[model samples]
Target: MRKVFLFIVLVAISMASYSQKRYENNYVSVVVPNGWVVQNKGDNGLGTELMSFYNDEYDANIYNFGMIIGFNQFQKPEFLLETQMNLKSSNPLFEKATFGKMYNSSFMGKSVKATDFKTQIFDETFKGTAYAFNEGGCTVLAVGSYKVGTKSDLPQIWRTVKWKNIRKDTHVYDSFREEIEAYCAATNKTLKQTPIVSNGERYVSVYLEPDANIITNTYKFVDMEKSSFDENKIEQIKQNLRPILLNILKATAKNAEIAAREMKEGYIFKYTYIDKNDEFLFSVKLTPDDYQ
Candidate 1:
């Protein structure tokens, strides 16, 4: 019996080590189990990132578990508490989630507030814990989902999220601004003169009508890449345009159906607006160059 117990303990330790994987950047480091894919770095937009680890092991169901980290010049002690209250009230999932009382906690020796929360989707209840901690002049968040009825090690994963002792180059925006001007001149579009500076990064807003047919809503993103000449950069612009597309679909065309297809370097967001009788009103191919 003593030998069997010792073997079981060794197996547990081995499995834990095998399941852990680490993701680190200049700002933060997090540990996630294998099978959690990291999103494209460019998709993070500026100093804030919403990275998720998605697992679709269950048929037709997906679980998103991850952290959001924001870098700022300075953060107050109340930052975490304010963020917790805001999330409890404003998060899109707040209405659907069943939350417990918020209580004080500490992570990596930094003061924090934590809450137990759960949400149901497709008849499966995803149990999770949310934490808000401010450390190293930044606001760090940890959110995770666990398989119900099991001993959860998610807090251990969160505890592994440590801040790095490095900072970003604040001049990236200035260099990107020059590129924006050049791209605008080449494409014959008016790039907004003023830029938004948040979290020590600059973002430029631009609007495109695509031949006087689509709506004139402006799209915005962090001015990271120098030019839209690259196919990959252009594709990233298309991803940024998705939210604008959905918001303007109704105003741009009646009963519109938006679809996207991948091209060599970029993508084509095809918008098909239909009439009351299901007849097509118009179709627009929203490409990356449109916003250049």
Candidate 2:
């Protein structure tokens, strides 16, 4: 009976030692498994804040068992996922990394888009999984990487996340996107009432399409045959209109708080002009250097 009681005590102690730790912020609450330590916690400077964890034993040399959680207020899940993937792919160390297809999956009680990836750095080959989902106004992304043959508890850790303050309302950025679309439509209607250019080119339409952090303003033009403008003439037109477009963009950015904030946060402004038949004329992309 004493031996049995001692065995029960030992089991209790072992369970206590291996218990998980919970971490929470305004965006999400998650569990970090035993043996893993927080490696880093800070904003990534590209509009998302990140927290990283790793197991000391498995990540002794290279990052064998590691996880990262990122939160963004306005970006969509797809945008956040693409941004994270691009950041990783751009790194010189991951040049040879291969990615698998992204598929729908459930993680942390939310439907998410998940992908698998593999990369080799030095003598270690690391396999990883990443997923992104939206919870309330926040877009959350989680990534886990482990050595090829190691037993990782990342899936268990992911299942422990609990989203706080759930809501079904549209995100702030989505509302802003609707406003911008309406504004563009109004501008297009006004432009239609007058000549868009002094050279008899009529305005076809003005539309906005956003991809990740880039906001594109596409201007459609017609009556190109009347102008008889070739490539050289189009180039000259673009050069002449560059400052005018820049001025308009600057004014809009100055007047709109979200536009200014987004610009400062490295959101790119792209202006594209095309013919009515959808033939590309030219495009000018403005980066932070040009805007700020």
Candidate 3:
């Protein structure tokens, strides 16, 4: 019985909300609450707030927060409210904003926190549910959401918020983004949109345009020499070249058409673009180190 209780306790800690430890001088200061976590942010150590995270308990859903310090003043909790909306509709907040519930609320009732929301900035709508509280010359926030089983769980999950000492660490997304971006850069390609982390380390970039044909042939010409290409050497090279494009596209969709084929001089392996359509436009030809 004791072991069973101990195991459950460990699991609870492991699965509980995430936050860094904050301190003042030599004293122990409270970090962000345990029920809330940070996400999509660069490192700012544990003291300065700037981040976003997925709340496992938020009705088993996902959300993110971007904390901005000095944005709000004083010891009072001044919370900023915003949404990622295009403002296409006449009234976005009152009508279209589905990111959260009710009027934009604040942590401190008195102070005002400036807000900036960008909807479809990258040609895709990112539903970011975020909240920020500025206090003690510092800022803490929670934003974003994740896939959940049912919407009913939201209230119960949110109830877990400790709202005590919020701890957050910020690390620039540049390092990691640059790492993945390097893969795309090497292949002379740019992601259709900035990636939304589908889950840790992995990013999801979806391109949605009215014209389906535009996506179909985008990658056809780039990879057209598959048939004649040496299976091992050529394919291996192609994988090395455009790993990002391949990973994101493959994860989102299926069905690719081979636009071209060649093998004599060099191995050519062209396939349907990520959004494979009849207008195949990508191709890549690789040759063994020795000769074509």
Global lDDT of each candidate: 0.44, 0.58, 0.31
Model 1 spans with C-alpha error above 4 angstroms: 1-20, 38-45, 54-64, 71-95, 166-292
- What's the lDDT for residue 116 in model 3? 34
Residue-by-residue lDDT tens digits, candidate 2, 1-292: 3312321221111122144778765456778766665433433222334455555523344344444454444445555565446544322223456778778898767798888888775557888877888766556677777777777767776677677674433343356556556555655553443324423344455566654556676666755542466879888987888788777668656543446666767777787877767778888888788778
- Candidate 3 structure quality by residue, lDDT tens digits, 161-193: 334443222233364333223333422221321
Deviation of model 2 at 15, angstroms: 23
The TM-score, computed over Cα atoms with residue i paired to residue i, of candidate 3 is: 0.25
Q: What is the lDDT, from 0 to 100, of the residue 21 in candidate 2?
A: 76
Candidate 2, residue 24: Cα displacement in angstroms equals 2.2
Q: Per-residue CA lDDT of candidate 1, range 1-292, in tens?
A: 3322321221111122235577666566778765444431311223444444444322233445444444432333344434444433223233257777787877666667777788764455677767676555455566666556545555665677776764544454464334333333422321232222333232233322344323222223233333423557456645664666654433323211111111222433454433233332333465556532
Q: What TM-scores do the predictions have?
A: 0.43, 0.49, 0.25
Find the 10 residues in a row with the least total lDDT in model 1. Answer: 255-264
- Residue 230's lDDT in candidate 2: 83
Best-fitting candidate, scored by lDDT: 2
Candidate 1's TM-score? 0.43
Candidate 1 positional error at 186, Å:
22
